[model samples]
Target chain A: DVKVTQSSRYLVKRTGEKVFLECVQDMDHENMFWYRQDPGLGLRLIYFSYDVKMKEKGDIPEGYSVSREKKERFSLILESASTNQTSMYLCASSAGTSGTQETQYFGPGTRLLVL
Target chain B: AQSVSQHNHHVILSEAASLELGCNYSYGGTVNLFWYVQYPGQHLQLLLKYFSGDPLVKGIKGFEAEFIKSKFSFNLRKPSVQWSDTAEYFCAVNALSNYQLIWGAGTKLIIKP
Candidate 1:
């Protein structure tokens, strides 16, 4: 079985504060992704990493950045939290080819609030 | 760019009701389809996926989906839904060219007791 764990289930931060959301996957998957899920807007991709130290910007990469220093860990960074950035953040990992195939396993998600 | 669309935003059904949730994608080339469910306060789980062959795919919890290439649709269905089946369903598509997944807005299913 694959397990994806997040550092926090819930978090609260004041505006301008820096915030970090961490995700660790037990499986040695080669791909990891960060997304923010908003009601009505669905899950918008924030960033993704195909391998350690490599990253790609997704559809909604603004106000967020990601780091994958290790194959098992992916970190999402909010340089300065803002009220609008409050949302349910999710992390997922997948193996196999880079595109068009593979099932992604997801973490429980972190609900972040920027006050 | 690839995109996905889910027909219903919210659906209410009594237990034992048959279920069908519509999903469609827009892309010119071959694509992979997936249906994922998220129970209240729980992480997302795969319901079913269609990559190739046997258009109909069955998944955990008795959920299934059919991929219709001509229609560009992949709809999820269940014979008889239970109260525990209540969850938000998301339909996603992956274009063969890239790793990016185009997602639908999602459909919230509520099964009454």
Candidate 2:
């Protein structure tokens, strides 16, 4: 069984504060993703990393950045948190060799509240 | 723009009632369809997926979905839903040539006991 774990399950931060959310996967998957889930808006991708130090922007990547210094860990960084950035953050990983048909395993998600 | 659409946003059904949720995608290429379920506080998990071969695919916990290429639809169905089946269902599509998966807004299903 694959295990994806997040650093925090819930977080609260003041406006303009810097925030970091971490995710780690034990499956050694090469592809990792960061997404923010909001009601009615669905899951909007923030950024994705295909390999160490390799990052790609998704549909919505504004105000957010990601780091993949190691294969097992992926970190999402908010330059300066705003109330609008409050959302449920999700991290997922999939086998890189597999095509788009590969199934992505997800973490439990971190609910961030920007005050 | 390519995207996935789930018709129902919220659905309430009694236990033992038959269930069906509609999902449609707007992509004109070979695609992989998926239905994912998120229980109350649990992480999202794959309910079913359709890549090729059989259009009718069965997944965990007695859930199933059918892919209709002509309609560009992949609708999920269950014979009888239990209270434990209450969850938020999301429809996602992955175009063969694209790395990102287009996702639907999701349907929140509440099963009454």
Candidate 3:
């Protein structure tokens, strides 16, 4: 069984504060992703890392950045938290050749609120 | 750019009812598809995936999906839905050049017992 763990299940931050959401996978997957899910908006990809220290922007990258210091860890950072940035953040990891759509395991998700 | 669409936003059904959720994608070329389920207060789990070969793929919890290339659709279905089957179903697509996934808005299923 693959386990994807997130640092916090819920978080509340003040406006203009920095927020970091961490995710770790036990499966040693090569590809990791960060997404923010909102009602009616679905899961919008924020960033992805294919390898260590490598990153790619997804559809919505503004106000968000990612860190992949190691294979097992992926962190999403909001430089300055805003009310609009409050959302359900999700982290997922997938391994092996992706051409054939491998299962991307997801963490429990961190629901953040900016006040 | 690839995009996925789920026509059904919220569905309510009685127990033992048949279920089907529609998902459509806009990408003419080769692509991979997947279905995921998120239970209440739980993480998203892989229900089924379609890369190639057989179009009809069975998944956990008696759920299945059919991939229709001509229609550019991957619709999830189940013969008899249980109350436990209630969850938010998301359909996703992956294009060749980009390994990232394009996701649908998702369908929230509610089963009444």
For each candidate, give its TM-score against the true structure: 0.97, 0.99, 0.97
Among residues 3 or more apart in sequence or in different chains, the pairs in candidate 3 whose N, CA or C atoms overlap within 3 Å are: none
lDDT of 2 by residue, B11-111 (tens): 99999999999999999989999999999999999998999999999999999999999999999999999999999999999999878988999999999
Query: Which regions of candidate 1 deviate over 4 angstroms?
Result: A97-99
Candidate 3's docking class is medium
iRMSD per model?
1.0, 0.7, 1.2
Two-chain DockQ for each candidate model = 0.78, 0.85, 0.75
True contacts kept of each: 0.68, 0.73, 0.68
lDDT of 1 by residue, B1-113 (tens): 67898999999999999999999888978999999899998889888888888999999999999999999999999999999999999999998788888889999999999
Candidate number of the best lDDT: 2
Model 2 chain B: worst 10 consecutive residues (lDDT sum): B94-103
Per-candidate Cα lDDT values, in order, are 0.93, 0.95, 0.92
After the best TM-score superposition of candidate 2, give how far the Cα of residue B97 lies from its true spot, in angstroms.
0.9
Q: Per-residue lDDT tens digits of candidate 1, residues A1-115?
A: 9999999999999999999999999989999999999998788899999999999999999899898999999999999999999999999999856466788889999999999
Query: What TM-score does chain B of candidate 2 reach?
Result: 0.99
Task: Write the candidate numbers in order of decreasing DockQ.
Answer: 2, 1, 3
lDDT of 3 at B110: 99
